[model samples]
Target: MHFQWYPGHMTKAKRMMQENIKLIDLVIELVDARIPVSSRNPDIDELGKNKARLILLNKSDLAEEKQNDAWAEYFKEKGFSVVKVNSKRGGGIKSIQGVIQEACKEKIERDRKRGILNRPVRAMVVGIPNVGKSTFINALAGKACAKTGNKPGVTKGKQWIRLNKNVELLDTPGILWPKFEDQTVGLRLAFIGSIKDEILNTEELAMEMITFLTEKYPGVLEEKYSIEISEDSYECLRRIAESRHCLVKGNELDTNKAAILLIDDFRSGKLGRITLEFPEDYE
Candidate 1:
């Protein structure tokens, strides 16, 4: 299936980010731990040039532990102050302040030399929709300061949040680039629920997911549903439908319902910690 979703509002969001980039001292970018490279917006690199950069591997808890460590090191090697965070549960949120200070130490020192003191580091929290930007901000500030939802486009405008005396955050709506040149990136984003499901073919998406799991994480589905695995993804999905009792009318397997259930299980971590992309593959 062809994967693409860039609503008109995203264009406006991109413009707003461009206008605000000049006011930011640091760019705190959140990327999904499972697909770090795919979830990142390439425009951010261009817009945030010369700014202190931090990459937070949000939803780290839902991804493999080893992959999470590898991704953190990968970003660190690229000069981003990396932190593995599970914002939903406050994991790794406490260290953010010190990391932020360290990330902007150069700016802070320059300020001190220029007789400026205690000016809060202004950071722009950004990522594609549903990658947990608002949730991370809420976790960092220890309060629900930004609006959050599981679906894309939940945040429509910008909001300035005072995180503390030394840090202020600008939360912007999630924006995807105009087009995904590499459809693989688009597919990964869709797998992670970054793309809205309304525009996707759930059965096809689930089949793709089945293929991935069968190759990368064999036996996971079999164990989860207590069904024998099949070489054909559609057959596997059918088994899942039967195992989960997803049926229509009398006894026809409701593969659509099963597909939704499977996707939801993967997103919610019931299918176990899984990472869709690896750093080595990108290299």
Candidate 2:
């Protein structure tokens, strides 16, 4: 689910979003719970303006509970209905229906005043690739009696999954591109495996992760790899290499192999529930 963004892809995605956004009354945004801010596309705010907004903190199972609460509050402060969810195991998903109604309350009230009645809230799921968009959709729309739709000669249009009497979701999730202009954003996305590894130096990336963990999530390296934290990130990496037996021929520690191992561990949640950025830290 790694994404490589190009200008052409960006343009096409934007076009599709514009087209689809018109068909929905609510925008359900999914962001990785660990790197909530960095995993977002700023363009969504502009495109989704005037729509009922709900931010679902996806992958909550892999993020610190305190951080997840803080993130929900952060989005709530910005006027979005927020829900912390772990799409992988269906955690917090049952509450989604209630939250969606709350988010679109104003819209429903307005419709009522205009004599509109019983209209279901139309919503769509959107996020950067590999942020578990598909998993969230499947989890929300599990095996049930569902309906399909088709427009004559219109490329077999979208099917709305009726979640209940008051909500219908778009079948396809919108894919948004990450902010590539910022080096830090790119690095964070890379660390989460949202971007291609070929474009990055694994050793350098691992060092950056080591530096972040030691400073912000203090003791993570020590607890997981049994390595003493050092002022030098490279030294910590070497310790991990030794503990993990990431050695080259002749039994010498292979720093490159160790870098890959460290990155994999962090991405796979082996390091622990971690949030790369925090609201206070950004402030």
Candidate 2 residue-wise lDDT, 1-283, digit = tens:
2234574577777777888787789999999998898989899999999999999999888888999999888888889889999898999999998988888998899999999997899898889888999888888888762754653432455677887779888877447787666677777888888877887788889999998898889988998989888899888889999998989999999989999999988888898898888878565
Clash count of each predicted structure: 0, 0
Q: Score each candidate by Cα lDDT.
A: 0.87, 0.85
Name the lDDT value of residue 136 in candidate 1: 80
Worst 10 residues of 1 by lDDT: 147-156
Model 2 alpha-carbon miss at residue 99, Å? 0.5
lDDT of 1 by residue, 88-125 (tens): 99999999999999999999999999999999898988
Please state every model's RMSD to the true fold in angstroms: 5.0, 2.8
Model 2: weakest 10-residue lDDT segment is 147-156
